[model samples]
Target chain A: MRYIKNPMEIEKTSFEIIGREMGEHNFTEAQLQIVKRVIHTTADFQYKDLLEISEGAIEAGKEALRNSPLIYTDTNMILSGINKRALGTLKGNAICYVNLEEVHKEAKEKSITRSMAAVEKACDENVDIFVFGNAPTALFKLRELIKEGKAKPKLIIAVPVGFVGASESKEGLEELNIPYITVRGRKGGSTVAASIVNALMYMIVER
Target chain B: MRYIKNPMEIEKTSFEIIGREMGEHNFTEAQLQIVKRVIHTTADFQYKDLLEISEGAIEAGKEALRNSPLIYTDTNMILSGINKRALGTLKGNAICYVNLEEVHKEAKEKSITRSMAAVEKACDENVDIFVFGNAPTALFKLRELIKEGKAKPKLIIAVPVGFVGASESKEGLEELNIPYITVRGRKGGSTVAASIVNALMYMIVER
Candidate 1:
C-alpha cells in the first residue's frame, strides 16, 4: 500500500477537535505506517478523520514530551545501539537492563530466562520516558510496575503496525495509564516500535 | 506456511536431541489467523522445540499446585476464560485472579472510550489460571509477581502461544516459579489455552 505523505493537516485538525494529537508526536516507521496506512485504507471520512484525530493527539503527546529526558527500552538491538544512537537521548541515564535472575530471587530455577529485564529495571530506577522499541511484554508489564510504584515512564511510545507479537501491547499501554501511538490498526515488532518511540523522543527531547 | 499437523512429535523428538520436560515454576491469543504466525516465517520450529522442553515440566507444577492454591498475574483474556472452558477441569481449590487494574489503567481513553480500570477488574475477577495466552514480554514481569510476594500460583500451564496478538506463553513458563506446561509450539488461544488448563485440572482435580 502507498503511504500517505504529510499528515500534518489531519494531525492538527484532530487536535483542535478532541485534543488527541498526532502531528506533534515523534513516531517510528511502524507507527508512521499505522497512521499512514489507516488513512489510505479507510473508506469512510469518519474513520479517516479519526486517524487524523489520533495523529493529532500523537503530535500533542510529542509536544508535551519535547526536550524531555528519554531512555530506550534496553532490548538487544536498542541496547546495542546505545552509544551510537542513544548518545544524545539517553542523557545521563544508564541504559537499563533487568537482571531477571537477580529479580527471580528464590524462584530462579523455575521462571523465564528473560533476555534482559530492561523494562523492569527502567521502572525500578524511575526513568523519565520508557521507550519500547518493540518489547510488548515490557510495555505490557509496565502497568504493573507503575502500580507497584517501581516503573513509571511518562509516555510509552509503541508502534504496533504490521506485527502480531507486541502489537496488542496497545491494550497493555492502555492498562498501564501510559500515552502511546499506533499506526491505525496493525501489529508491530521491537525495531519498528522502537523507531517510532525514537522518532517521537527525538522530536520531544532533541528538537 | 503450513501449520505442523502433529507438533507434539516434532516437539518431543526431532526438534531437539533430548526432549524437554515440564518448565521450572516461576517464569513466566486468538485472532485473525486460525493458527500461529511468527515474525520470521521460518525456523520458528527450532524455537518451539526448545520451548517445549521447558514446558514439559508442567507435571511437576501440577503436583506443587495440588498442595496449594494458584495465583494470577492480572486480568487478561486467557485468565478470564478459565471460568467458562476450564470450570469442568479445575475444582476444589482456592482459585484467585490477581486484581490488576494497574496494567490497563494507562490506556483508559484510547479503547472505545472504556475504562482500563474496569477491564482490569473484570480480568482480576475472572479465574485462577491465566490460560497463559498473550505473547510474553521479554522482560518477564510475571517473575516479579511471584518473587515480590504479589503472586504465587502453584501449577502454571505456560502456553506462550499468541494466535495473533497473543504469544504462546508456555515458552517462558520456565521463568515462573510454578510447574508449567508449554504445549506444542503453536496450539494456543482463548479456547486452546483454557481447554489445556481445564483438561490438566480435570486430570488432577477429578482424581
Candidate 2:
C-alpha cells in the first residue's frame, strides 16, 4: 500500500487518474465536473454509458443554482453531504423532510413511504431542485406531481439505487420530457446525487 | 411508475427478491441479514463476493452492540443513517468527529484531512466500533494506530468508496489480523456501511 502524504494530494491525484480513465468526453465543462465527481465517488467507469444528461440540462441546473434555489432531497444523507457554504452564499437551503413528524404521520395515513410523503410536501412548496438518491418511490411520486402540474423544477436529479423500483423509476423519468440528470439503470445513491449538486455549486462559484 | 403501498411492505418485498437473487448461503442468520441489507441498498449482487466477513466477526460485532459500544463513523451521513433507537436502547452513542471544531483545527495543524484527524481523535476515545464509509484516509489512519497498539476495536466496518486509496486501505486492513467486515473494492459508501450496521442492530432486536 502506498502512503498517503495528505488528503488533498490524494484527492487531486485521484481526480487526475479519473480524468485519464474517462477521457474524450463530449460533456460541457460544467457537466464534466459532475461526471468526474460521480466517477470519483464510485470508481465505476460504466457510468459513462449509464448516465443520461438531458440537452442543456447543465446550463439549466447552473442557472437554477445561481438563483439560490431551495434544494430538496429524499434522504438526509444527501442533505447533509451538500456544501452548506455554497448554498449559504446564495441564500439557499437544503431540506430533507423524511424524518419530520408530519411527514411520518402523513405517510402512515396515506399508506405511502416517508420519502414519497416528503416529495408530496415539496410539491406544495416553491422547490427549485429535486434530488432523489435513495427512494425510487419518491422519484415516481415526483413524476406524478409534475404530470398533474402540481410541481415543476428547473432540474430533477433522479438517481435512486436499489433493485425494487430503481431501474423502473429512471425509465419513467426518461419518458417525462422534462429536464433531468439520471442514471439509466439501478446504480446510484445519495453520494452520487450530492456530488452532482456539489459539482454544480462549485461551478457556480468558479464562474 | 408504481405506487408504494407502504415502507414496510416494499422493504419486505425487496428483501425477498434479494434472497432469491443470492440463493443458498452458508451464512448464519445474522450474517445473512447483513448481506441482504447490503444487496438491498446497492442492488449489486456482486457485493456477495466483494464483502469479506472474518470468522466470528458477526458475533464480535453483536457482543459490542449488546454492550452499547461507542460507535464512530467517518461521515455525518453514516451517523445520521444509524438506528438511533437501537443505540439508545443499548445506552450507546454514535459519534462523528469529522465536523468537530477541534478536528478541523487539528487537521489543519497536522496537514491531514479532517477525516484522518477524526480517526486520531477517536483513537484516544473509548470506541468499540470503527465505521469508515467515506474516507479511506481515516481507515488507513486507524490501521496505523492499531499497529502501534494504541487502539483496539471489537469490530471494524472498513468500506470506503473511492478510487484514491480505497482498495489499498482495505487491503491494509486485512493484514491487521483484526475482526472486520469489509468490501474488497471501490463499491461502498456511507449508505452501505450504515445499512450493515442497521442490519446488525435489527438482528439484535429480532433475536
Candidate 3:
C-alpha cells in the first residue's frame, strides 16, 4: 500500500473505503452522487491533485453530514464518532463536518480517525485549508507550521469549548489571525464547529 | 476587572461562576490542595491572581466533573466539539466521565458548557493531572493549540466523554500526534480516558 500523504489522496482513499462501507447501506442517488463527487474530486483532478483531494473530502464529508443526520445525537458519540451531529453557523454558511461519528481508540477503516487523518492528507495534498476540530497536538503542529510560515490555513479556530460557550476557541482563532466565529464558550461543541464549517462551506460553495 | 487572557484567569472565572451558580459548593482542604497543585503544574505560575482565582474555579470544575462528568459527555456534545461523526486512533488512553445520577439538562448545576470553560484552568493553573469528561470544545481548543504549537499537552483523553459513550469526543485527538487514549467504541459512559489519565498521572507524578 502506498503512503498517501496528500489530503486529497488520503480523502480519495478514504472515499473509496467509505464507498465500500456505504455500498452495503444502500445510499440514495443524491447521496451516491455526493460521494462520487468527493471521490472524483479527490481522485480525478490532476492539475492540483492534492488540493482536489481535500476539496473532494470536504464535499463528500459535507454530503455525509447532510445526508445522515444523527438520530439520537449523543454527545459522547459526537466526541467518539458513534453518530453524526448537525448544526448551523453564520460564517460561510457551509455545513462543515468533523466526523465524530467514527472516532474510537483503534484506527479502523470505519472510524473518525479517518477524518483526523485528514491533516496529513491536507498537508500532503497541500490543500487550501486545514480545518481541525480539537486535536491539541495537531493544532500545536499547525501553530508550529504557522510560526515557520510553512502552513496556510485561512482560518484556524481553537474555540475554547467548555460546559458553557465557545470563547476559548474564539480566542485561539483570534491569536491565529484566522477569521472564525464560535458558539461563545459553553455553546461550542463538535456539532457547533461542524455547523459553523458547514455553514461556512454553504456560504462559499452555494455562492 | 482587567481583561486577562491567561488560563488561570479564565479558569478562576469558571470556578467562581460554577460555584456561585451551583449553590456555592466549596472545595475541601484536600481537594483544594489538589487544585493548587493542578494550578501550579498546569498554569504558568505567573498570573498569581489568576492562579488564585483559578484555584477556586478549578476546584469547582473538578468537583463538577467528578459529580457530573456527563455534562460534556453526549454524542451531540462530542460531535459538536470534534466536528465529525467519527474518529479513530491507535493511542490516546481516553475515558468517558459522566455523572451517574442522570439529571435533566435544565436542572443540572453544571452544563457541558461550563465544564468546558474550565479547560483553561488546567492549562492556566499548570495543573498536569486534569480531566474533562464532556467539555469537547475545550478539548478541541486544547488539541488545536497543541497541534499549532500553541500548547504542549502531554496527554488528552475522553472517557465515556459522553453518556454511555453515547457520543465520543476523542475523535479529534485520534487524528493528531498527541498521546491520546479512549475506551473501545460503543463502550458508552465508561471510565476510559479518566481512569487512564489518572493512571498515567500516577505513574508519572509518583515517579
Candidate 4:
C-alpha cells in the first residue's frame, strides 16, 4: 500500500485523518488543534471528549510562550517530547526538577514524592506555565500552593496519568480560578502533556 | 483523600491496583509484567488485551539486554524515556538515528523519511534489539531489510503510534519469523515502547 514518505506529509496526513475521524465537535480552533494533536500522538480518539480547555487557557499559554516563559514540567519525558526548535524560536525553555538533588533531599525529608517536592520548589521560582503528566501528587500539591496564594502560574497543563488520585486531582483543577487544560479522566500521559505545549508553540511559531 | 506519597510505594500500589483491576488474563508471568507496566504508564487498560508477545520474545529481549547489545530506537522520545541507569548497569546503550546528519541527508537524497533512512543506516551497524515507537515507515523498512537477509535483530519491539500505517506495520510483524512484541492496533507510543524495555530491565536488575 502507498503511504506518505515525507515526515511533514505524514504528520499532515495524520492530522487530516484525525479531523475526518473526529466528525463534528464544539471545540474552538485552538482547542481543536490541541485535541487533534493529542489524538495524533496516541491514536485514541476518546480525547475528543475527554480534553477540557478552560476559558482563555490557550491565549494565556501562547502569551506566556511569546514572553519566553520558564515552562516547568513534572517529568523528563514531557521535557524531552516538547518541540525544542519551536520552543527555542519562541525563547521558552522546558525543565523538570524530579531528578534534582535538592528535590530528592526535600522528598526524603518531607516523606513526599519527588514530583511533589519538585513542584513545591518550582513554586518559588515564579514559573510561568506548569505542566504535569506523571504524578497526581504534584498536581495536588500545586493546587494546594495555588489556593494558599503561594504559587500563581499563568497557565497550567495538568494531565497526570495513573490509577491513584489521577482523576480526582484533575477534577480539583475545576475548583481553582486558574486558566488550565486537563483531561477529564484517568487517560493521559507525558505524550499528551507535551503535545499540548507543542501544539501551542506550533500555533505561534508555525503561524 | 489519602494516597501514596513515597515514589516506590506509589508505583507498588499502582501495580497492585492494575493487577486487581486486570483480574484474570492468559499472559505468562513475563508478559503480564510488560502489559501491567504499559497500562501503568498510560493508565489505559486496553493494552492488557492489545499487547502481543511472540514466543521467546521476552526471553530474547532479556538475553539481548544481558549482552550489553546496542538498542536502536526510531525516535529520540523513546531514547529519552528508556531507563538509562538500568541500561548502564547492564552496560548497554540506546541510540536513535532519526536526527543524525547522515540520516537527514539520506532522506532528502532518497526521497524517503528520516525514520526510514535511519533504519537503513542502522541495518549496517548490526543493531541487536530494534525498537520502533514513532515511525511505522521505519518498522516497514526494517521488515524489508530482514526479509532480504541483510538484518537480523535478536528481538524487535515495534509499537509505532499513528493513524497511517501504524496498525498495518505492527500487523505485518506477524508475517516475519523473528521474535517480536507489539500492540495489535494503533494504540501505542514512545512511552509504551520504552516501558517494555524498562520492565525487562527491572526484571533482570531488580531481581
Candidate 4's fnat?
Answer: 0.80
What does candidate 2's lDDT look like per residue over A184-206, in tens digits?
Answer: 88888887899888888888774
Off by over 4 Å in 1: A1-74, A80-110, A113-117, A148-150, A160-167, A183-186, A201-207, B1-38, B41-207
Candidate 2 matches the true fold with a TM-score of: 0.94
Clashes of 4: 0
Q: Compared with the true structure, what per-residue lDDT tens digits does model 4 show for residues B40-83?
A: 99988889889999999999989999998799998887888898
Q: Return the candidate ranking by TM-score, descending.
A: 4, 2, 1, 3
Candidate achieving the largest lDDT: 4
State the displacement of the C-alpha of residue B137, model 1, in Å, after optimal TM-score superposition: 35
Backbone clashes counted, model 1: 91
User: After superposing candidate 2, which stretches have Cα over 4 Å from the reference?
Assistant: A23-25, B23-26, B172-174
DockQ ranking, best first = 4, 2, 3, 1
lDDT for position A38 in model 3: 27
Write one digit per residue (lDDT tens) for candidate 3, span A25-143.
34344334433432221121111111111213434344433442221111232233321122322111122223333333322453323333334334443333344333333344445
Task: Output per-candidate TM-scores for chain A, rounded to 2 decimals.
Answer: 0.52, 0.93, 0.36, 0.97
What ranges in model 4 sit over 4 Å off?
none
Q: Quick one: RMSD of model 3?
A: 20.5
Interface RMSD of each: 16.8, 1.7, 17.9, 1.3
lDDT of 2 at A77: 86
Best by TM-score: 4
Superposed by TM-score, candidate 4 places the C-alpha of residue A66 at a distance from the truth, in angstroms, of: 1.0
